[model samples]
Structure formats: C-alpha cells, structure tokens
Target: MQKHSSAIWTGSLKDGGGSLTSQSGVLSATPYTFATRFEGQNGTNPEELIGAAHAGCYAMFLSALMSGAGVVPDRIEATSTISLDPTTEGSPTVTAAHLDVTVKAPTDEAAIRDFAEKAKAGCPISKLLKAEVSLALKIA
Candidate 1:
C-alpha cells in the first residue's frame, strides 16, 4: 500500500513556513517552520512525524510477531527518539533512532526481546532509515 503526504512551503528557507497534510487527514494542514524544526518552537516537524511513524510501526510489528508466535501480548508500547544532527555536508541528517519499548505479557522475556529486536530491525520505517537504530525492551 502506498501512502502519501504533501507540504506547501512559501518564502525562503530560513523564513519559510509550510503546512503538511496527509492523505488520511490525520495531519491535516499541520504547520511547520524553520523555528519549529530547529528552535523547538510550537509546531510539528518532520522529525517528530518520522519518530511517530517509527514508533507506531515498530509497536504494531512486534505485536504481530507476538501473535504469530502464539504469545498474545497484553500491551506493547514503543517510543522512538530520533536524533537529527548536522552532517559533514552541513545538512541536518537523521543519525539515530532509539526505541524505548515496554511490553506487558506473561510470555517469556527472552521471546519478547527477540520479537522486539526483530521489529526494530524489520519494521518498514526502520528499513527505510539508514541511521543507527537501537531498541531497549522492558517487560512489565
């Protein structure tokens, strides 16, 4: 399935502003600006959206792996921390995606960790990102 989102930007790079809209309308006309992206101003940024996608995909994939392994999980929460740092080319690049995952189930912790590691490496977003990805799994 192909998904899509578009952005409309105006003005120069530093002073320009844009609105991001998703095909699903979940991010209907979300505002973003240079200040919001680099200065931590009030608005959504691409990195935040990427982090959300990574977390959501990883969690869902892990849950599916659990179900496929006959270990239905009670809960699986994945939080992604994306690091955007300047590269040698003077452009901001995604350097890492760290996932702090918490799982609640009666299954073996080793099994959960195994599935979580798989999800961390096999998620579509994870595969798309060339940055370093790390997973920290906690069982509850």
Candidate 2:
C-alpha cells in the first residue's frame, strides 16, 4: 500500500498556527499557494478542511456509484460548504455540510438521485462527520 503525506505546524493554544505541506517524498511546494493555504489567527480555518474532505469524498463516492450502476459520468463537480456553530462550552463545532453536485451523464433522473443518496451515505468522510449533511444533485 502507498501512503500520502501532509505536514502541520503549531505553537501555543490561542497563538498557534499550521500549514499542510505536500511530502510523499516528491519534494514540491504545490498546493501551498497563499490562496490555498497560509492562515492568520482568525482566517483560513478548520471549516475549509472539512469542506475539502467532503468534496473529495463525495466525488469519489459518486464515481464509484456511477460505475456500479453501469453509467460513466463525463464530469462530476461537487462543492461542499461546512457551517460551524458554537457549543455551550464556547468551542466551535461543525453543524452542517451542504453539497452542491453537478454531474454529466446519460442516466435517468431516478438512477441519478439514487446514486446521489448512496454516495452521501457511502462517503467515508461523510460517515466520519457528526454534522447534518445535505446534497443537491443536478444530473444532465
């Protein structure tokens, strides 16, 4: 089996910071642009991580579902938004995840919807999250 890699940095509790670096021994600074990374104390935070995980997981799940259903999607684009709400203890937790998925395929509406629902449940990241996740799927 092959393993992927990422790096993080930290300091104190409130004054800490981190960055994820690509390091499969490939030695590159890709995915480290200011837009994709670099965060302040109150910027570029955990919700972004959750969104990334959700989008990736959902895309993979949809691909698998399409393949299993004898339909090959020409394109699958999924955007996931994660909302955070504060707990009673004043800590922020993910409250919800919303996925907008657009898929191009030659499948019927019912099959598309069934695959969308299955993908939502079968995504590993979706299973890991405690947040309420919803999806809007558009198939054409």
Candidate 3:
C-alpha cells in the first residue's frame, strides 16, 4: 500500500506560507509557515507531523509484537520527540527521535522491554528515518 501527502508553498522562505493535504483528507489544506515552523506559532509543522507518525507507528508495532508473543497489552502510550538542528550545512536536519513509552500489560517487564526494543528497531517509521532512534520505556 502507498500513502501520499502534498504541500504547496509560495514566496520566500522567511516570508512564505504553505498548506499541506493528505490523500486521506485528514489534513486538507492545513496551514504551515515560517512562523509556525521556526517561531513556534500556533499551527502545524513538519517535525510535529513526523513525531505524530513515529509515535503512532511505534505504538501499533509494539502492540503487534506483544500480540504475536501471546501477550495482549492493556494499554500502550508512545510519544516521539524529534530533534531538528537548524545549523546543519545546507538545510536543517532532523538529528534524532526519542521515544517515551508507557505500557500496561499482563506480561512481565522483561517481556515488555524485549518487545519494545524489537518494535523500536523494526517499525517502518523507525527504519525510514535516518536519525538516531532511542527509547525510554516504562511498564505500569
């Protein structure tokens, strides 16, 4: 399966603005701009979107891994923090992604840790990103 999203930008980098749309229509003409991205304005940005995607992918992958191991999870919460370095040579670079995860499960902590590590390394988003991926997991 394939997924797609589009962005349209107009004007210079500092003065320009753009809108993003996804094929699913979930993000139809969502606004993003220099202020939103670099100035912390009230709008969406690419790093925020990447964080959402990474968190969602990690949660789902962890659940699947636990299920495959015959342990059903009660709950899994994942938060991804994407670090962007604007001082990079040509353009800003995403330096790393840190995942903070909390899991409530019927299994032991050791099993949960094993599955989480596997998911962290094996998730599609994790593999797709070139940045260093690190995880901090808590079993509750």
Candidate 4:
C-alpha cells in the first residue's frame, strides 16, 4: 500500500511556482508559489497539506481506537497547526504540530482522552513527522 504525489516547479525559488498532483486526483495540478507558501498569500502550501494529512489521519485512527473499545463517536474534529521557523539558520524548519481536537461521544471523558492520546502517538502521520506534536482535546 504505497501512495504517491508529484510536483512540477519552474523558475527560481523566490520567483518560481509549482503544481502538485496527488495519486488520488483530488489535488490535480494544484498551484503553489513562494508567496503562497511564505507570504501567507491565498492558495495551498506544503505545511497546509501536511496539516490536513495529520488531522485526517488522527481522526481516522481515533475512530478505529474508539471502535475497538466499543465507544462510537458522533464526531471527531481535529485541526493540526503546523509551525514553521522561517528564520532557521539555513532554511525554514517545521518546528511543531499542535492538534486541537473536539470529540463528541457518549463515553467517559477519561476513556476518550486516553484514546486520543494513543491516537496522537499511533497515527502514521504523527509518527512520520519529526516535529514536536501536542494535543488539546475537548469533550463535547
């Protein structure tokens, strides 16, 4: 089970642009540029894509953990905030990924929190990232 994505870039780094395409075709030729990535211009960037992957993986892993424990969740909303340190010595570095999650379930808060912490550590994306990962869980 391997997935892949491709990108094509043209021109110099600061003045260049790129388009990304995923194997699933959900992001067919999506546009990204230096301004979009570093200047907070409108459009998508690698950090944003990574955050989406982290959040989605976290939610799905949490659901699986809940199912294993016989606790069904009505909702698991996760937001991954990726922090980039642009002033790093040579190049920008992703420093941290903080997950803000809200879980709606009919289970004990303690159980849900335990499962969430496990999911935070167990998710594949979480394991892939080298940045520090933190979670703030809310019961609803």
Per-candidate Cα lDDT values, in order, are: 0.89, 0.73, 0.95, 0.95
Evaluate model 2: give its lDDT.
0.73
lDDT tens string, model 4, 63-95?
Answer: 999999899899999999999998999999999
lDDT of 2 by residue, 1-140 (tens): 54445645556544554565444544332233232333333445457767987999999899998998799988889999987664436666667899999888898888888899999988988887954757687785
Question: How many clashes does each candidate structure show, in the order listed?
Answer: 0, 0, 0, 0
* Segments in model 2 whose C-alpha atoms lie over 4 Å from true places: 1-15, 22-43, 131-140
* Candidate achieving higher lDDT, 1 or 3: 3
Per-residue lDDT value at 4 in model 3: 86
Clashing pairs in 2: none
Which residues of candidate 3, in runs, are more than 4 Å off?
A: 131-140
Ranking by lDDT: 4, 3, 1, 2
Best by lDDT: 4
> How many pairs in model 3 have backbone atoms within 3 A of each other, for residues 3 or more apart or on separate chains, i.e. clashes?
0
Off by over 4 Å in 1: 131-140
Q: lDDT per residue, candidate 3, 1-140, as tens digits?
A: 98989898999998989999999999999999999998888999999999999999999999999999899999999999999998999999989999999999998899899999999999999998965757687785
TM-score of 2: 0.68
lDDT of 1: 0.89
Candidate 1 colliding pairs: none
Q: Cα lDDT for residue 136, model 4?
A: 80
